[model samples]
Target: MDDQLAFRADDQPSSTSPPVWRVLAVDDDVDFQRATAFALSELDLLGGRIELLQAFSCREAALLLARERDIALVLLDVVMETEDAGLRLIKALREVIGNSETRVVLLTGEPGRAPAHEVMRDYDINDYWTKSELSAERLLTVLTAAVRGYAQLKTVASARRGLQMIVESSNALFCSKNTRELSSKILSEIAVLLNLQAEGIVCVRAEEGEGGVAKARIISASGRFRPSVDASLDSLDSPEVAAVLRRSLQGQQTLCLSDCTVLFFPRFQAGADYACYVATERVLDDTELELLKVFSASISRGLYNVALFSRLEEMAYQDDLLKIPNRNALIRMLDMTLKDESKAERVLVLIDIDNFSGANTAFGTGYGDFILGLVAKRLCDAFDGNVLIARVRDDLFAILGPQTQVRAADIVALFRRQTRPYELGQVHSLSSVTMNLGDFTGSAGVALQDALLTLKQAKRAGHDQHAVYDSRLLGAHAEAYRMLLALRDAVEAGHISVQLQPQIDLQTRRVTGVEALARWRKADGSMVPPLSFIPLAEATGYILPLGDLLMRLALQAAKELADAGYGDIRVAVNVSAPQLLQHDFIERFVAHLQAAGVRPQQVEVEITESVAMRTFDTVCEKLRALREMGVNVAIDDFGTGFSSLSYLRLLPADRLKIDRSFVLEIGQVSNEQMIAEAVIQIAARVGMQVIAEGVETRQQADWILEHGCREAQGYLFAKAMGCSDLLRWLADWPRDRA
Candidate 1:
């Protein structure tokens, strides 16, 4: 051992040198352990000293290896306590603990028990040698080679870790939507790269010469740096860290010091500089240096893009004046919150300042803006980190979080603040208007729309009120939207038609006129009730096309009737109040009828009493012009609406059709009947021809005929049918009294 030593036994490495390469010697032979320890006492390889560890058995060696993570090599006797104890430990090292970097060499006294060739092939050991063959010089040579291999594997493993981190960082860059995310990812990745805990700060500052502390913004932080993440530079809890980063940023280069390191990244835009400070041991070798350089370079491009994203995010998602999130940001938060099923009691509250527009009008826009800013601050203070608050509109705010934190009662109480005069005049309370409990799944924009619609309904009910979004309200709106689309398609595809129900002279039972009713049939051969789609079309302004289609069908029927020797029979087409109030309704009516070679006298403009009553003066003014043009006007479904004496006296109709409701009861029991008779009397005084509808039985027809309704149309005579069917029936009708 004395002759095999490379250096004197007293020449031990100092503590200031790089970390030692730990070698474990596992052998039950105590003499062999002492000899091996002495042989490599003064040796060093790859700028690291060799520190030998001893264990008398495989179990003891395994326990020592478990505690030390950076062990470089293991020299073991093939037969420790058992014949294959060392071999079993090797298998445990390679498979159980997964320690592939540490090199293992097997040395045994009995060469015949384990053949050298087979042992090396069957195990992952780097070298196999008999105890006698491993002299001090040969062991020295083997130790040097094993240490070299371990050093190479360690470098490769570190490089592999760095590469994996780069891949993960790339994904982080790809997934990061804003600067805060990018900054956070960079910190975590750096922590992993340095093999340290995540204790760092990533600060973004303007170019140092441009301005110093004023432009510094701590974007992301973890562990000890977290408290100062949002603090002003002058008031930072970690002022020493800020100082170091500031000095590094001023250098405009990466700062590698003995105590800490600061990585400088100059963003391509915004004239910004980024500095990352990690609290760990000092920098030493090029591998760590190269790893950090590669990281900084890869993330430098990310920094450029992230700066642009930060600016764009500030503009698109954040409100400029109020310095808070805007509606778009709120939408983003809502989408994230809704997707996370683990979060409980998610609530989105929308606050609308009651009569805000009036306040904006009463006070100036400047004062209104001041009030909005106050409201934003108030909401932020009320919820803090518990909820996400946003200025969703000029006078509205939205809060999203757990229901317990984002409570309507709390919001209302916040708004119950005093509305009194201040230095900037007066401001109104931003009352809680509506809330959406996001217990359902959907897009964020749709959720907000439903909330707004609910707020609209609540406003119609009263003011300073808080309401939850009723799914039925959205359902009704969606139904109307679908109905309008279907109605438009039906009109464009010519699926709408006018079915004429024959109106006869009550005395002669002779067909005098036909009431043209609009009908819609779907591609599936199912009939859509007029009661369902008609009101939707009228309310949604889809009535113009639908009404025009019905008018064309009616005129075509009139022309076909005239050609078939039924010229005296008028086709009464029903027109809704919306269609009648069109700017060119009268002109379009005359032109449409005349274009089909059907005279205005051959068509009657029929409207329901409800339509006429709703737009009484407008309907009277428009229909009087049509009546003067020889287009006879008739009031259908009379007495079912506001048929007061004054409105009846002023109604300018050519005919009055009593509703089927009044006529149905006439045959049932007429002991107390005045509605039909009174309608008849009013029509006679107004000089309007009277017709009764829905007459199925002869008794209803006789009762209506006795009550001065000479013209009638019902299923009793003929049901409403297609024009061809009506034409065939008209040709075979009885011209004389039944």
Candidate 2:
């Protein structure tokens, strides 16, 4: 026979009362079970009564604990069907079942079978007493103390477990950087935190009228309510769930019922609130209710931070004016595209409006912005397939798509249609528009940079021109683009150092000055030659910044040399044509000289013969300005490509350096020596100093000096070295002793 008894004050339901404690009694003796139930019914612990759950054997007690997590105590008999049956049951309860929160007490008809001290300590038995000693009064005393201890332990354990849940839930919720992911994480955490079977729905106030909530929508849901996510709250299958959610939102409070609990929490933004309805099978105790309250606050704050982060992140990755993906996001998109093997047939295209800066000046910035948006929309509409179109920068839009769908001719034709006049505000209208485009066949590494290179070529080819990225155009090895990116990092990390190579007087064999050469040393102790990457730098616009850095270092070295009694030494630095034409380049160079405390005459700017061949007014003016400032300009590789006398006459140059090719062929070929001789004569007629480079042999030096070359540099004197090495070389100069 089984006896189950629940002792209560009255049958009337009251909200103020605590839940009753559940105690399971396991014994085959039906009479003893009833007697024990009668004894436990007479007492109360902490304003809560006890309900004695009946079980015939160990199997029944194990099943009861498995079904009920709230069971407070278990009473087991030692000598039941087996002599140690109750002892084995305690082992299963404490070890196999892992119900450490519930209290276990061992009872024995025979005291000698299991020692009281050993049983209580070893088996996790809380209380042990002989059956004969358990009188009605004694049983009441033992049960009251046991139930009180269980309640305290449960509260502490619940608090610990709840805090752990909150930490885990916060991690899951905040890891998401968008609303969609946030909703999914929030709903999943709610179920885990509540220890429910994932049956819940999150309802947010969609709109509010003067009276109350006009419409509420389900943001997220789980388990049985999962289908209701992102749906109207009114469409819930259970009217009870909907009504409780309404009450929760309207009152801005929490409601607890027999089967579920509704909680209302505030959003970060004012007047915006959300309600969570969780289905539970049993009534929650005070500990669980308080835990819920604390977790709800945590969830609210987590949601607010996530929302704020999402907004900030979007701003970081998106263009502000055009509201499209910026350069950084476009690069990430290209990287992702490269990772996808299926996108092998795709092409990356860069579109640039021809003379856009001119248009921006003529039409004003507002009109320019309107035109950008118009172009973006038209490009999106023209591409039939799914494509990623981004405004990388001002008047520059990039698109990635399959070659089968987007061909180069198709893009040119589409933009050609945009050339038709557009009537703006009936007064101001665009009479015509033209675009330059560059495309690459592969969606692989550095596609944007490749497209950019092609775009530059297009611009050079004139308006409305387009070209495909060809590695042959790069004029470097196949891995040149990768090396370019690495070079940029090297510059920023200060890996580029200036090395000084001595220029000697050819006749005296004495060092005249040093040339500052840019040398790169990587982390793995490998050296990158300037010839390998200088062309890439020039093409990719890195030369401007690189030239500025070298100029500053060269100035500093020149200052140090002048202070070290080598005051007559002049440091010559190679300057690219683009660097000379950059805005404010002269001003910044003057500032660098002032900062280094070096006079303008102590430095020389070296330009290639090819640079003088191209005539830009700004470049010519800047060169003349440098000469006027007492800075010397030298035409490097004078006997090399485009050695035109007209260019030499037009450029404001004070020195001409004979090309290394002529010097290297001095003994090998007669024409090379004659070319070197003619270059020196031209420098004399033009009133410019003459220097010869790559004079490695005694014969080459003798020939250059015989031809009236004033200075020469070669490995015969010293390779490029650091400042310390140069100082040592200066002290050990053979010319000074001679």
Candidate 3:
């Protein structure tokens, strides 16, 4: 006992060292318990200290074990107030309380009183030692091995729990839809995964900077740093935390400190950049550091998914070209605003630039984009604070403002405001622009559709006016849409019929050729006016199909005319600009001619001057191809479009068909006759023939012939009629002239 006391005194370590072992001893014998305690104190495993706990009874032992879950080893007496009491307590610890990692060693005064080997196995006790035979050396050896085993098992259990926490955090954080919640969860999970007890902060580097001291914004903070959430990293009161946060962000890697650990989660592919700083007194070993690395990787993946989802949501709700809220976002705004009954007087105004495509033709696409941007800015200015402004189309802008700010007079004043001229390529200046605006009184359902309808009506009314929406406009728009659908059906069903008006030779009074006119005949035997449906066809791109059908019919009729002894006559068909600009248009037209077996000479292609002006290069190429095929090209309604005669020299036309407006009141007005003469002179100078249209009176015919226009077509000669009537009229032309 003296030697053992000396050994323990010599082996005792300093008080500053960590407690490495917690052992429990249970026995009713006071002398044996004292001896066991003294023996444990005598031995030291390096600088590791042992903490001893005593329990005189089985009940006391079970309570102590239950209270101290991390106890490393338990020494039990087989005969403690009852036989096999130690075994029963061990069973409670193993099966009932489920403390499987703690090792148990049994000591008995009587070996026969102890349970058999199978009973010991069932109890899951680690060792069996008779008290009489047990030595100090043997006790030290058992405690050493049992404590070592316990330490290893605790380490493994901690690592497993850490992995489980990481998996749970991944599930929780990945469910967050945006950056805010993702960041908050990251900060909290860092503490939980690492078993941290101190403060931490999560930050993101928001902008690129030149210096290594890049600015980082804190997204979330916990513990003492909770108030620092959403603050700048530079504003943190603790210099150590700020330094570690900057180091993590700039180095783009993990950093370890004495009292804290900083981890960098770089932007995943193109995701949001982030970092986390955890301050704790607990030291991180190799196992914890490795687990943290794995945990951070999972966090980065979840953040990347959240960022990608947010970006997709933004794209879905925002306009790409205008960089403003688009139709979808506008719908959302309307939904929220309309549901709030407090703000009921909201108004929406839709503005459209008049002839924007013409401006694009005048300038380039870049200038068109510039103009749209300018209009967007102007709309924003006009609406001022809290109002929503967006570019809805290439040439359209939408403004949502209070009704007081966007009244009819206010819209008028907005357009009439004096604006500085815009320079084009440092040369040309545009002083002012015109727009049509449509206004609706409420932010209620489908207001944008109503605004668009009113805008179309305003444009049809003329430029530089405001149209207020009403129920009548919706009915009108629906009727117009129905008419368009019916016209399309008409073209498909061959209900579109052609009437031919004869072009007469004024001097010889003989039919020179005929012009084909398209008319829509409804299913109900009612006729739709060409004025009402033709423009609708042009606007809706139905003109292409309608034009193709008309061309085919006219060519077939021309072939019949040639077969019926009218070979000298030529059939003129009007072609739209869209039809001419279509791909493979010339090839398709030639195929139609050949299928009808009509010579190109007997078919004339007529296009309005607007087609030449709008699509100059394409129209010229098509006209040259027509001439190459021996089809004479004529400009129909020439004087009405493109007042500039410079296009005449560049155009490949055989004749200029004077617009009906000039010849409508010919000779009744001196300027009208003089204008007709001037057009004829211009055509003659270009080696092109002159034809006068709408010659409704003999005076108009005589006036055109006096002005050197030899060809004329109007009611004075004959009105447009069906093929049968035209054939009959041609057959009796000599008698009709008499």
Candidate 4:
């Protein structure tokens, strides 16, 4: 072994001495070995860094090689102690020292002794060089190529291992559901995969207060830096740090510090924004960056999922239009309030807008929406600290407050005063807001439907008012609603009966015709006035059926009167606005008259000027159709509609009835008399008969008669009486002198 080491030293001579390859010479020929070591020493392999090791046999080379692991290349003679001894060393080096990564070059003096091809194929050595071709440059070239190849392979393998770790780490980090947990895992995984010195994740919440404030909470951390935990980025005091963090949060871009790199990923859910930060200082290559990008996308998606789930949960209990708690949320809150012993006293106030439909028509849907939102805002602002407000419908709002602080009057007043005139663009709009208050009076339990009913009564009584709920109010409202239902049933069952007020021709002192009026007599024999129930019927859409019933009754009555020796008298029946505008109303009326076997001229249809003015074209068409059917159409209550004078000429009317208001003030107001006279003159000029209504006294009747009015109807002649009463009165009246 000592001789091998000494010969290896001679193989690589010093530059000032001689060049050598420093190959391990394991030859048994002592003379040949001395000459070969000296010759190889002059051939500088590895820049003369190599040194020869002469064994003079296989056993010596084995002993020397076992002690040295840094030998670059080995050259052995084929005729050593054992021809395969060099092969055994390769195996030993691989198994024992684990030096498989190292390069080994073999040399042989006898080209045929080991057979260069056979040794190259069988051994793990890198190359085969015969003694004759083993020049200094050739050996140097072979050794250099082997060393460079090993270095390249080591680099590739190390890079491959790093990429695999990154991929595994990304997968682990992205699999987490909780954002904080996911962020923590990301930092820890990155730290382990990249071998980072320090790592952390900073999650920023941007929607804390009004207009939003940025607050970052550190989810995970390692090394000496304290985790941000409860500390907000806005409270960081360092302007530069806050600025950078804010920019990262806003732009959603990665930032690099002196020792830390941060990547910002904007997490969006249902169109709202949040941010996630992954930071580390370790150097990352393309593979790590790509892996991090994919991890960021996964984190963003997870955050989006969480946000979406939260939003869906919120929507489950939120009103879509007002963004307030809906009925479900209100019930839940009420349940919670009731369950708590500390929250004993609770008050609920239901607010409703007065004449909301009128307001809707006057302003428009857009303005109506603005008014509703304004009311909601007022309710929210006025009792924000003491009450919770929610919109239940387009015009209904609910307020929940402490019983001690809330009163029925207080809430009613609050709602009434909240409807201040609002400006829409340049237009000024006003809404008459009202509300009904219901308290837990202990007599009647509070119910949502009952409260709504009380509000309905308050609106029906007249608008811009409120009705407090009491047992009496509830009873009355229930009775009114029951009456309405009974009235509807009566009309539906053909139980409605008609009475007629005679129109007396004062000059002749005889009844010319009678106006048909609806009368509702209860089972107790008490009468329900036309004024009392007609408006309700109109509002409830029962007027359409009621009008049809009245028309049929009036036609039958006229036909009966004609058959009973009262042929000249006609029956006039009033038509509501809704009835007049009903589709195919004229055809229906004509069909009814024909079915009753009454001549069209014997029955007159009276439509108020207001209804006629509202749908002038439609009313004209209907009147024209009626005229064509030989039915006389009259414009009732003229001079009260505020209509254009030209409309009176254009209407296809057989007669015009002067409204009672003008007749009442005919002698009181000079302008009223002039207006009434002008209306009569216009009707005359248009070839229409003018009938003065409500001629109650001699003076009024005389004035109307002297004015050349063709007809007059009022209480003086006869009040509206049932059929039997009218026939009895007709039997007592004097004969006509027409």
Candidate 5:
């Protein structure tokens, strides 16, 4: 018993609080044991709590090991009871006690006394060190590494089990069809998995309407965080939490509250159709991060399925495109508006773009598409407040504004003004388009379809203009519909003819060229002006094929004149905006010149200022190529549109036609004369000749000639005339006359 008392001290637990490690020291010499324990007590493993269990002999150490369960590390000295006693104790620990988790570090005073390699190979000790080389820091370092390894291994094992449980339970919950039930199960399972004290799940629909009012409702909760029967989850008001939830919903991101060590997972499924917020006050580790990522993906898929189901259920009441309310939505809104006392006064406006089909046909189907997209964007941009804008057809849009007809009109006016000059890429230049607005009083109780028909009538009259719906226009549309049908028939019957307008050179005084303009001749031998049928022609896309016919006629006349000793004379043809943008314009024009046996230089293609500026880069490149092939290019009515002098220099042209407005005001306005002079000087500098148009009076023609304008065309020289009149004028030439 006295000999066994040598190990009795080791069986007693140390007095340290929160025991860090229990180390058993084995030595035959009592003083060596006492000295080692004193040295180790002064050591610190990052200020760790340590307990020193002493044993004076190997037998005593073995006895102590059988009693203590938490001995983390063993510091064994060689030659304790015998020369190999420490080594024997290591074997006993492994075989008898089965304490493989405890780390054994061997100590030796004379390493040469034992076969160091053999002893290490025979025992499962962690490390071996000589007493002369041992220090407190070194011992502490070895112990810390061992203890940390043990802790990490335990944590990894525990986390693996936790993850397996989470995955299994999440799969079960996700299989449930009901969103509320699934949400509840998820919250409770996550809470249990994380060992959370409190947990809840909140689902919210973010406001996309006028005021951005969020519709929030707590769907599920568990544990102490659960709300009572009297407690309303919808009334849980915390602006910060709400903002965080909204951000998570919108962005599909997770928000972590480190203060409470809580995590909120916002699940956005089916592109933000539904949002779910899962909140838990549990400190998350690496396992939780992996679990959260997996759970969030499952939740996203579930939410998507739920949203798809809801959408299918509500398919009859939603817009297929733009994802806004549809006719059903509008009717529902109207019903709600009528029910509400606050919305007693409201205005509904039906807007239709003038000649939208004509614009679409002139540009292309692509331009029509761009206009539709622009209309949607502009409508959204203009009335972001209590307003609903929807497209009912290709060219028609509707707007609903509450109260104040004057306010609604102002909004419509602002929208038209803003969208008038909107650019539609390279195809269409900044279009000066306008919306025809028709407003109905809130008290009128008129059907929406009736108002739409009234708006259509106003659009038929003219666009870039508006008219309030009246019974008179409705009556007139019924009559005008017949005329529109007749006009379409006339266009199809080839009732249009090419009329030549001679352009005389101011310097030469002989008819140098004629512009072939279109005219409509009825079966009764009466002629109609271009303004009467051109719009109808453009709208029906008759202009494309019609323009082709006119080109053939114009080129034939030029060829006949050239064949008849008028080789130096040229014919100017005005190209429409649509024709100029056609990809085949150059090929077709060149083909016509070839068939006519006329030089490319004999045909002067005149393009409007607006058309030239809008298609500046494309037109300039095309014109340069045409001029390279000897086709003459001229800018007609240059000052009529907003063209910059810098852009003029960039244009590849043989002539610039000064607009008639400048010539008409040349004698009246000094600024007009200055502008004309500037244009002439710039044209001359760039090696381009200037032709003044609309010179009706002698004073206007004289002012233009005095300003160094090289060419003039107007009544002052000769009014535009038929091909026979041009031929007579050319035959009796007055070269010196202005």
Candidate 6:
């Protein structure tokens, strides 16, 4: 039979009375049941009187157990209805009724029906005895211990359930993106753990500033407390609840009052202290109080992690020294603004400090940096905190604001203001034009490039320059970028050809050597001047392969001319500084001549004097290796560069090719003639040959020879031509038509 509430008293106690323990007795003998009831009926077991329940058969006992909530003990008879009928009831009680918490004892009139030791050991029985052995005192003692064990197990299960709730709630709270979300979750989870109503308020305050919790406010609430959401501590309607929160905010420890609980989460850096208040009618047990403390620690750790994430964001996007936005932050702001069509007439302006290097030299770097910080501060004040200013470079600042406030005229006026006496430097400023809100399409990178392009034009004009961006401004920079891409492709394809310019011995008027010049003609047969692309090639580092191609083709032409009886010839090709700095330049040079089947003696390497003057020891080592291999080295553009006398005397060179600027004015400018003569005399004293470039007239040639220089190359001899054409020109040399 399923159990009824045969008796119950004080199920939950407050020390006013002892806990009631229920016990059931199962037997088929009617007299034994009455006798057992008479013996245990008035017994005070486990500090409370027993409420003896009766069951006549195994099925009846199983029913009794299924009906009861906390049946503490079961008394059984061995031979009832069948030999194993009582044993079968135990199985039904444990499996069907699911009463594992109740203790069972076997009391039988016939001991031989079930073995005493076996029944006690094999079955889940607390004791096995004949009817003669179970006295009133022994029964009371056995019942008291079972009831105590049951109460202990129940308490353990309750604690395990609370711990499980804590683990699950922590997972949800840790994923909360902000404090507001975390506040709501904390209140709901604590209510669930305590088996109370989902009603509480989460309040937080910055650490005990100005005393008490006047600044504290409720961030989240639910149930009856929902109306108090966002209410400050001073505005709380319930004075008792407000006092509890104030105590928690000021104190470092959690408080479990007689009618409520306030959890105090301590302050972590970048975060405020949080106090969560929940109402209850009675004080919690030790287990509940301990669980809340553990829950508080776990939630506090999550808050600390959120604070750390926010701090890392500041470090990433804030300038370390200027205390302003950095380039990354500026770009992020630009992207956000451009993505929103509702934004107003805003423009990006770049301000650069002209001659900034001179400032670093005039003042020490320490003072220069201090001046830059001052500039950042002044710009912020001048804009009246209305614009977003960024330190994009050491000496360059960018501003994003309404175009009316950030106009070029205002920036120029600010720079020229007489009261500004710090003397930072002449400042150049430019603002990008306002693009069409409905039609403009580009990324933040594109917008930044436009601002930078305008700044470049302003800076190039002079100091204290100002301009507004236009479509036509700085078109050359964009065009140069496009041309660099094409040049890289052309050099890879080896499309540039070499032209030979004859260098004639002045007195003999005979061809001695030829200078190889690189020439580029596009598919349309339009020539790109060397002035346009040569510097572009050097600046973009395409000169490495361009240098290699020129050398390979120059050597091939030299081989062809040698085959045509133009023997003992040297063809000179220019090498840039970046190419000369390569560790493998000398190795590659030897490999190129060997691959072309041309002798090293037929090649001449021309490095500008400016390139040779830097890193004297390194350049001398490479040049000496070249001369050792029977290759000739000449300093190209001789007088136009560093003109270091030690460079000339130190370089192991074969000739100094006088720059064309000095040679072109040789007859017209007396100073040019003197410089050319001085170069010729210096070449003689240094034991090197002298070749005057750009000999356009017989008078210029005569000036060179009269100054004791034998070599000259210009239009006076022949313009540069193909090797086949040069061979034809060579056969017609010294043939005059005038």
Residues 465-527 of candidate 5: C-alpha lDDT, one tens digit per residue = 455556555455444444445554655687755656656656556566666777667789888
> Which residue pairs in candidate 2 collide?
none
Candidate number that wins on lDDT, 3 or 5:
3
- Model 6 spans with C-alpha error above 4 angstroms: 1-176, 180-202, 206-244, 253-263, 267-272, 276-328, 340-345, 349-385, 389-399, 402-440, 445-494, 667-678, 681-687
Best by TM-score: 6
- Report clash pairs, candidate 3: 8-42
Error of 1 at 697 (Å): 3.4
lDDT of 1 by residue, 403-474 (tens): 767788777776453654354433344446445454556667767766876786677666777787777876
List model 3 lDDT by residue over 1-738, tens digit each. Answer: 112111123556666756678889999989888988888885675348888889999999888788889899999887777777888998899888899889988887544444233344356776677775476655765676577657756765665465445546667777777777877787778777887754655555555556744567777777778887777877888887787777766666667777777766665432645667777566789888777877776776677776666655555556556677666566677667666554447766666776665666678657877776666665666666767776554566666666667654554455443354354422121111111222333443356555665566566656665666666656765676778767767877989988999999999988999999987788889988898988767765567667888988898788879888898899999898778886578999999998999999998999888887776777888899999999989998887765467777988889999889888757567764467888899999999998988888888888788879999998887889888898899988955542
Against the hidden reference, what TM-scores do the models get?
Answer: 0.51, 0.42, 0.54, 0.53, 0.45, 0.58
Instruction: Give the whole-model CA lDDT for all candidates, comma-separated.
Output: 0.75, 0.72, 0.73, 0.63, 0.63, 0.73
TM-score rank order: 6, 3, 4, 1, 5, 2
lDDT of 6 by residue, 1-738 (tens): 001101225568455677677778899888889988898867776467778889998888877788886787888998787979998888887777776668788887545446443454356665566665566645654565456556644554554455445446667777665676777777778888788888554455544437553468777887767787776777777888888888876665567789888777666422667777878667999888777766766667666655654454454566667888877688898888788864457777777777665666677667767767777877888886667888875567788877667765666456564676555553433232333222335667566656665676567667766666665554665577667666666766665899999898877777889999999877678888888888876754556667778888888999998898887768887888878887678888888888888888888899888888877889999999999999899998888865679667989899998988888776567764467888888999999999988889888888788878899898987889999999898888877730
Candidate 1 ranges beyond 4 A from true positions: 1-315, 320-324, 349-385, 394-397, 405-443, 446-495, 507-510, 521-526, 536-542, 613-618, 639-651, 665-678, 681-687, 705-708, 735-738
- Residue 269 CA error for candidate 1 (Å)? 17
lDDT at position 426, candidate 5: 19
Better lDDT candidate (1, 4): 1
For model 2, the superposed segments whose C-alpha errors exceed 4 Å read 1-173, 176-195, 203-215, 250-253, 256-259, 269-272, 281-285, 383-385, 412-445, 476-738
lDDT of 4 by residue, 1-738 (tens): 112111122355555753333356666767667766676664534344456677776677667777865555566666566656666766666676666545666655433334433454456566666544555545445665454434434444455455345445555543454555655665666566556644344555554554565455444444432455546666654455456667776665566555455555543321234444444544567677667666556555555544543454455456555677655566566556545554546756677765554566677656767767777676666775657676655567777668776555665555443355353422122222222223332211234445655665566556455555555665654455566677867766656888888888777777888999888877677878878778766754557677778888877778778887787788888989878886768778878977998888777889888888876898899889988877778889898768887887898889999888877876787754466777778888999988988877767777777777858888767788876687777888864322
* Candidate 3 segments whose C-alpha is farther than 4 A from its true place: 1-331, 348-385, 388-477, 671-673, 735-738
User: Listing every candidate in turn, what is its Cα RMSD in Å to the true structure after a full C-alpha superposition?
Assistant: 30.4, 28.7, 32.6, 38.9, 33.6, 32.2
Say which prediction, candidate 3 or candidate 4, comes out ahead on TM-score.
Answer: 3
Q: Which pairs of residues collide in model 6?
A: 1-60, 1-63, 1-64, 2-63, 2-64, 3-64
Worst 10 residues of 5 by lDDT: 426-435
